[model samples]
Target: MQPGEPSARFVDIELEPGDLRLRTLVPADAPLLVEATSAEPGRSLWGPHPLGPHSLRDAQAALAEWDPAAPGQFSLGVLRDGRLLGAVGLIPERPGSIEVAYWLRPEERGKGIASRAVRAATLWARDGLAVPRIWLEIEPGNEPSLRLAERVGYRFEQRVPRHCRAWEHQDADRDTWHDCLIWTFGTGPA
Candidate 1:
């Protein structure tokens, strides 16, 4: 990563398949943020501490903070026919691995939008960024997420106990933690 170089290849990438598209997130997407947090405000692992209007501000601030050339952890807005469907993020967690995070609006679920988005993102990370491995951490019992990962070619490796908690439950008791399944995309099954 250089001072002015982008952390990922999202800048040159514009994924558009069918009516769906994935583009680097911008402040203009703040309204979409508001729409997204309407149903589940203050609940996201990838947004502000309290996900809401305040989170929108936070997201805006984050976008402003980045130099655009070298974005660190970046979020991309998922849109269909010019409407926001959800968001996906690429976070370089370590040297050889990048974490893939995504979510879709309730109305957007079950439409295969998320699956398409994940597949596109992983492909970008693998080919564009030359990422050796991709990781997706999902809370236990989240069948949809698990299935999405599986459908996109990720295989379950192990469960990390208390690795993370739902964003809404962050203030709950310490024992109230989410057992996340660590799924990975690598050369072969782990």
Candidate 2:
């Protein structure tokens, strides 16, 4: 909530890098998000993220609350050339701080899409959102995510145990108990 900002509502955002484009998430995106993450060799983001088969309807419901022109929680659709890529978030929490997270389609991985989206988010959080701290948490086992966090200028802060819960799998032994690595950027908020 700021003096003047968009009301809590979904935004239509479009970011283009050469031939690629990133836009805000929409309710129609629910199925695509589900499909992308559910596709095989998907061990990438599935383990630690709560998004799963059951998330489609729920994610769609949540789309009503994501606002890009506002100064609060933001969830955006990751789009490239009008195709759904994934999602990215810069959540408002801890006052003057936000937690940044991004997930890309398996086929979209390794193309630096997530990195670019993250960089865009960091810039937004810093300038658009006027936040001092842009933080992110990555499951210890997700090396690529960790690299993205670091590559985006987020520095290693601390390890928080069981900081993330993986609800996708039925096997408890999947050790869904994740150790989270916290990364901070720009001198973090006081």
Candidate 3:
């Protein structure tokens, strides 16, 4: 990829997604990271996550010793003029398949940022990584997110029942389940 260009990875598919730049996630983004994590009631809705401030320093410290191209679990920071809008990441399911996920700040909602980010990711998964399918897991109540998956070239392929538990929103033992809407795109950019 050219300078300022995103990689073929799910998080950096766009060769040059103008305005918004996909940059390597650095440890110094701890404060902004803290803000985003604390924006929602739950740090994350997919699984058991901390309910308060995150180990920003520790996470950043760890990133310092890691390599982005090492192998698995790649995460990228979505930035616009150095401001953190959100993040995009890839979670490999197996040898030739992976799941893509992303999150944007509440204030950045309705700005098409998620779709662009997903598009970049989709392109990477399909073209760069040579992956066959890309799945996006969204909460049942997140209508905007659900629509976003479709808008970005993903369609509802299946409804995974009780796929996730929002341990923070609902009681940990309540079995607060969320349906996972599966979306897919072409062999290339979705």
Report clashes for each candidate as comma-separated counts.
1, 2, 1
- List the candidate numbers ranked by TM-score, top first: 1, 2, 3
lDDT per residue for candidate 2 within 92-116, as digits (tens), equals 7776777877777767789887888
**Candidate number achieving the greatest TM-score relative to the actual structure:** 1
lDDT of each residue in 71-98, candidate 1, tens digit only: 4677777877667677777777765677
Predicted structure 3: lDDT: 0.63
Model 2 / residue 99 / CA error / Å: 0.4
TM-score against truth, every candidate = 0.79, 0.74, 0.73
lDDT-sorted candidate list, best first: 1, 2, 3
Give me the overall lDDT of model 2.
0.66
Compared with the true structure, the alpha-carbon lDDT of candidate 1 equals 0.70
Q: On a 0 to 100 scale, what is the lDDT of residue 86 in model 2?
A: 73
Candidate 1 runs further than 4 Å off: 1-8, 11-18, 51-56, 62-71, 167-175, 188-190
Q: Pick the candidate with the highest lDDT.
A: 1
Q: Whose lDDT is higher: candidate 1's or candidate 2's? A: 1
Candidate 3: list runs displaced more than 4 Å: 1-18, 26-32, 35-41, 44-48, 52-55, 58-67, 169-175, 186-190
